[model samples]
Target: MEISARNSIKGTVKKIVHGSVNTEIILEVASGVELVSIITKSSAENLGLVEGKQAYAVIKSSDVMLAVE
Candidate 1:
């Protein structure tokens, strides 16, 4: 909520793919524009990420992270 990173895109969770170690999440930022973020499986679950849920795609330097409230 109060951080330093400036590159943040609000979008809805579009898709999710689970792997053994990581999970792939796709966020639809715009009509056809989407951002994909790969995070740890436990992290994804901890965030309660699900399709149609609102989330933020935080981009800092070369890393893309996901955040929720």
Candidate 2:
């Protein structure tokens, strides 16, 4: 994967929540932080996302708007 952003984190797919419309993919990164991404059901099916699969969570600092305590 191309590392265009400094906030990019690589991890494995730990769990997947396939909703009726959209699906949520959970990834476990090296720092023990979990990254959650929402994608379309069709995209999830096409990508064949499952647990224990390696994936990259590409994140940009600008995309992250807010964080809570």
Candidate 3:
């Protein structure tokens, strides 16, 4: 499929947290680096996102923020 997003990182599904409205997906892109994305439950189900599955984090954004504690 064709997509407009330029950032596409391949990763494995580490964990999935299902909420009442949305689902939190944690993807391990590298040995220590990980990315988290929150998507609708229906969308997640449609994509068949589960642990140990391979997926891509398709990022289509203009800005990304970083924080420090």
Candidate 4:
């Protein structure tokens, strides 16, 4: 798929958590690294996301803030 985002990371779906309105997707980008994303339940179903499915995490943002406590 073609996308405008430059930070697209390819990974495999590791885990899925379904909520009433949203679904949490955990993608393993590296051997020990993962990214979590929350998307609409319908969208997740439409995409047919399941464990072991390959996906891309396309990040498009103007600013990313980091905080440490």
Candidate 5:
């Protein structure tokens, strides 16, 4: 499939936390770096994301905020 998002990282599924409606997916993009994303539980189930599974993190955001203390 074609996507406009340029930031696509190949990562492995580290963990999956399922909530009532939304599910949190933790993907290890790099050796020690991880990216987290929240999607609908139905989507998660449709993808069949399990621990140690290989997946890609497609980042297509309009705005990103960062804070430092």
Candidate 6:
């Protein structure tokens, strides 16, 4: 897929959490680092997203948010 996001990281899907409306895909990148992507169930199914499958996490700098506790 052609994503406009420049900060793209390739990783494997490590886990999938299906919610009532949306699904959360967890991807494991380098050592102990994980990236999360949220998508609709239909979209996830359409993309055939599954654990252990190769996928790309497209992240844009503008989309990132910072928080402190």
Tell me the whole-model lDDT of each prediction, alpha carbons only. Answer: 0.96, 0.87, 0.96, 0.98, 0.95, 0.91
For model 1, the superposed segments whose C-alpha errors exceed 4 Å read 62-69
Report residue 1 deviation for candidate 5 (angstroms).
4.1
State which candidate, 5 or 6, has the greater TM-score. 5
Once all C-alphas are superposed, what RMSD does model 4 give against the true structure?
0.9
lDDT of 1 by residue, 1-69 (tens): 866888899999999999999999999999999999999999999999999999999888966589999
RMSD vs true structure, all candidates? 7.9, 2.4, 1.4, 0.9, 1.2, 1.8
Best by lDDT: 4
* Candidate 2, position 68, lDDT: 85
**Pairs of colliding residues, candidate 3:** none
lDDT of 2 at 22: 100
Model 1, residue 15: distance off in Å is 0.2
Provide the lDDT at 53 for model 1.
99
- Listed per model in order, the count of residue pairs whose N, CA or C atoms clash below 3 Å is 0, 0, 0, 0, 0, 0
TM-score of each: 0.87, 0.75, 0.89, 0.94, 0.88, 0.82
lDDT per residue for candidate 2 within 1-69, as digits (tens), equals 557677777799999998999999999996678989999999988988899998888777665477789
**Candidate 6 positional error at 51, Å:** 0.5
Off by over 4 Å in 4: none
Q: List the candidate 6 regions with Cα displacement exceeding 4 Å.
A: 61-63, 67-69
Per residue, candidate 4 scores C-alpha lDDT tens digits across 1-66 of 888899999999999999999999999999999999999999999999999999999999999999
lDDT of 5: 0.95
Q: What is the lDDT of residue 15 in candidate 5?
A: 94
lDDT for each residue of candidate 3 in 24-62, tens digit (9 for 90 to 100)? 999999998999999999999999999999999999888
lDDT at residue 22 of model 4 (Cα atoms): 100
lDDT value for model 4: 0.98
Clashes of 1: 0
